[model samples]
Each structure stands twice: as structure tokens, then as C-alpha cells.
Target: MTIIRQRLNELRRRAFAGRTGEIELFRSMLGAGGVLFLHGPGGIGKSALLDVLADVAGTASADPIRIDGRDVPPVPGSLQARSGSGRTVLLLDTYELLAPIDDWVREEFLPALPADAVVVIAARRPPSSRWLADPAWRELVRVVALRNLAPHDGRAYLAG
Candidate 1:
């Protein structure tokens, strides 16, 4: 088990390059409350950054619940029940695929989450205008548009 864990950690370290700032931001936001959206074009490392955020949440003893939009059911029954009373980090990947539930999630589901629950959404585009237009959501939502790795980081990633 220890060896397996070590290998997993090593793999994670390699897979998540040039994402320290984003990971730190996610960690800081977990305690502040609200939603964080990391959006960029395909292959811009959004998924990798989400993976790092999950690991950071685990290390902080927070519950990291990952939802892949492609596989999740539309209604997402009992999702709130799983949140419990602890700090829960909800990571939503491929968010564009869940457009059918977008309104529900933004208007109803997210509002119902526990106070300590923080959501991190990764999509190909920025969040809907509604999130920014509403005074309440505007204050709560933070958007980070990811970009390609710096040349130095790219070199380090390749060398690893």
C-alpha cells in the first residue's frame, strides 16, 4: 500500500506541472466559500489543475468529491447528502457536457450546498453571464482563465 501510494504521488507530481499557483488558489478558496471556475481551451491543462486541487484538498483533510459531467446523471440525486458537515471540495470536470443541468446547478444546487462547500468547475469556456450578472453570484464566483505553461515549466515538465 505504501509503495502504491508513493507511485501514485509520483505520478501526480509529474502530471500536474506548472499549476502551483492555481492549486494554492483553490486551497485558499476552500475556506473562503464560493465557486471557482478554471476554463480554457482543450489541452490547456485544466484537468491537470483540477487533479492537483483534489490532491491538495485530500492533504488538507477535506472531502474531495469529483463529478465528471459526462458520466453523472442529470438530477444528481442525494449529492447534497454526501456533503455532510465537513469541508467539501466539489470538482466538476468537463462542465460543458453538463449544460442541461447548468441552470439547476447555478441557481438551486449550488445555493443549497453547505457553507463550507467549495466548487471548482473546469470548462472550455467561462461561466455563463448569469453568474456574473447577479450581485450575489458576482461576489461569490471567481474565474481563472488558464493559459499554456511557461517555457521554463514546459522544459521542466519534459525533463521529468
Candidate 2:
């Protein structure tokens, strides 16, 4: 168990590099009853950032439910049922694959969630214009464009 724990810690450290601010911002936004949409190009570390956010949610005693678009059915209702009542953090990865249900999620599923439930989406593209165009959603949503790690952080990650 100790060896497994150590290995997991090492893997976590290696998976995330120089994303403390992002993680903290996600946490703060969630605490304030907000949703986060993280987007970036391929291999830009969006998935890794989601992993870190999950860890942060766990530490905060919030239930983190991770939904990968590749594995889930391409339906909005399917995701709606996944979010049970509680202080839950919904982590949606590969969100671009679920483009068909994007409007449903933004308009129906998210609004139906409990006030404390937070949704975190990581995608390869920015959010649809509908989210930005709507004056109401614009206030509740936070969009972050992830970037590559710094040189020092990259070196530290590789050295580890």
C-alpha cells in the first residue's frame, strides 16, 4: 500500500507542472458557484490540468465525477443522470466530442444541477458562441486557455 501510494504521488507530480494558479482559480470559482471551461490545442496539457483539479476537489472533500466524452454515450441526458445531488465537481474531458450535446448541457443539464455542483470542461476549442453571447451565462462561466509549461517547470517535470 505504501509503495502504491508513493507511486501514485510520483505520477501525480509528473502529470501536473506549474498549474498551481489554474488549480487555485478553479477551486475558487467552484467555491463561488461558477463553471469553468478550459480549452487548448492538442498536447497543451488540458487533461493534466483536469487531473489536478480533481485532486484539488478531493482534498476539499468535494465529490469529483469525471466523464470522458470518448467513453460516454453521445447524449445530453446521459450526463444529466450522472450528476447526483451533493457537492459534486463534474469534470468533462474531450468535450469537443460531445459537441452534439453542448447546448443541452449549457441550457438544461447545468441549470438543473444543484447550486453547489460545479462543472469543469476541458476541450480543444473555445466554448460555443452561445455561452458568450448570452449575458446570463457569461457571468457564471469562466473560460481558460491553457498553455505549455514554463522552461523551468518543464525541466523539473522531466528530471522527476
Candidate 3:
């Protein structure tokens, strides 16, 4: 079953449409030790982009560690352990679920990562004030607003 799912996901990823600019921005920041926060309404393709970004990380010779926020515990230790020290790309999806530990993730967990780690966050809403208010984060964080796909891209994705 897992093998089948992996194959299916690979096919879908190949057919994934649009967001070329977003993908490029993510690629530029890869291994740059910055936060790429992708926010939009539910089902807006943030998770899908992360999937592609994970593959991008692989091609760049970086190991990608993806953790869906819903599956993460509140403990920072657990996340640290799962991510490990070698991960160059850390993808966090469904980030709203991690609200309970948001501050810790921004303040503690992220700060502890290796200098070159790239963290991509997919959430339903824009980042909270804490993330934006911090002066130090201003230079390190890049927020990308995800809008709906264009008509042609939508058609291509659906037809694929």
C-alpha cells in the first residue's frame, strides 16, 4: 500500500501545475537558512507546493524532512529529534495545528537548527504577529501569499 501511494504521489507531482514563481522563490532560498512561509485558505495548494519543494531539495543534494503539523507533538524535543541535524530542508505542513507551540518553534526550535537549514511552512492564514514583529526575523523570513491558480494552469492541472 505504501509503495502504491508513493508511486501515485510521484505521478501527481509530475502533473502538478502552475506556481512557477513560487517554486522559483523557494528554490532561491533553499539551503539559505531562512523561513519560507506559504499562507492561504484551505485547499489552496500549499501542501502540494511543499511536495514539489521536497523534490527540489533532493535534486539540490539536500535531505528533506517533512513533518505535517497535525502529526507533530507539542514537545520541541520530538521535532528536534525527527528533524535531526542533517536535514537541510524542513517542511512543515498544516501549520495551524501547531499553534500551541508556535512561539517555541519560532523562538527556540528554529533558532537551534543548523545555519543553512531551510524551513518551509504551509498554513491556512498569514503568519502571526510574533513572526512579523521580531526585528531579527525580518531579514530571514520571506512570506509568499498563495492565490488561486490561473485559468490555464487550473485547466492543465485538472486535465492532467
Candidate 4:
């Protein structure tokens, strides 16, 4: 297996830690979803975690497309042309740069998403709106806040 897959497996072991509930959440999203958001402040492990997730998706034979917010396309329709059929995962890092939720949803976020793939948005915060605040989006959008690793966990992670 590739190093990414190995590292992702390790992350699954450490982060999920026998928690089927959490595993199922990710699994369900991979199978079918509305949207999954991993939001946290800078320097948080958000990017690292996203890397692991993308790795897993690749291992599962999914095509992972990574887009830096700085280079995002200007229009949403362009997304459909870019992402074809199959399991196409669209990941946007540093998504906070795309403000005004409506524009993002229409232009960059929505169109780029393939019908049969998982869409992961790693941002500092969710959109500030009533629709985003709704419980459905809240459930679909898993916000994993960054937390300090315990000394032991840190040491173990490094050793791994």
C-alpha cells in the first residue's frame, strides 16, 4: 500500500479508536452525502486530517481532486466539466477565503461536486446563515474542532 494509505489507516486507528459511530459517519459520507465540512482554526490538524481522508478515498479507488481556494475557478458550471463520472472527491483547503455562502455554493462549491463522490470542505468556520445553522446541514457537515494532542498521544504519534 502507499504511504498515504498507511498513514490514513494509522489516523483511523488513533482518531477513531474503536468508535464505530465516528467511523460510520465518515463511511456514510463516502457512500452518499450532502456535504462534509471539517472546520477549525489555522495550525489545527485540519489539513492533515483531510490528507488522511483523501488518502483513504484514493485507496478505495476514488479520484480525489484537491483545489486550493486561491486558485478556485470563477464559475460553478465549470465544475461539472472538470469532475466527470466515478467517485470524484473535491477537497478545498483554506475555504474561509470564499465568503458569501451563496456565491460559494453556486459558483465553486456546488458545481465542482461530482454526483457520486464525496465533497469535503476544510474551513475555519461554517457559513454564517440560518440555512447552515439548520440541524440537517449540521449533521451532514461534520465539524471536527482542533484539539491539543495529549503529551502521550503526541509522543505516540511521532513514534508511529
Best by TM-score: 3
The sequence of per-residue lDDT tens digits that candidate 2 reaches over residues 8-103 is 866876756786778888878677777899999998888778878887888888879999998888797679767756787999999999999898
Candidate 4 residue lDDT tens string, 34-74: 56666777776666666666666777777777765666654
Off by over 4 Å in 2: 2-6
What number of clashing residue pairs does each candidate have, in the order they appear? Answer: 0, 0, 0, 1
RMSD of 3: 2.0
Clashing pairs in 3: none
TM-score of 3: 0.92
Winner by lDDT: 3
Q: Root-mean-square deviation of each candidate, in angstroms?
A: 2.0, 1.9, 2.0, 4.9
**Residue range 1-160, candidate 1, lDDT tens digits:** 4798788877877755686778777778877878999899998988778777888888888878888777766564634444455676899899998877788888888988877678999999999888888998888888999988899888887787
What are the models' TM-scores? 0.89, 0.91, 0.92, 0.67
Ranking of all candidate structures by their lDDT, best first = 3, 2, 1, 4
Candidate 2 lDDT (Cα, 0 to 1): 0.85
lDDT, residue 122, candidate 4: 75
- Runs in model 3 deviating more than 4 A are 1-6
Give candidate 4's error at residue 77 in angstroms. Answer: 6.2
lDDT of each: 0.81, 0.85, 0.87, 0.62
Candidate 2 TM-score over all chains jointly: 0.91
Where does candidate 3 have its weakest 10-residue lDDT segment? 78-87
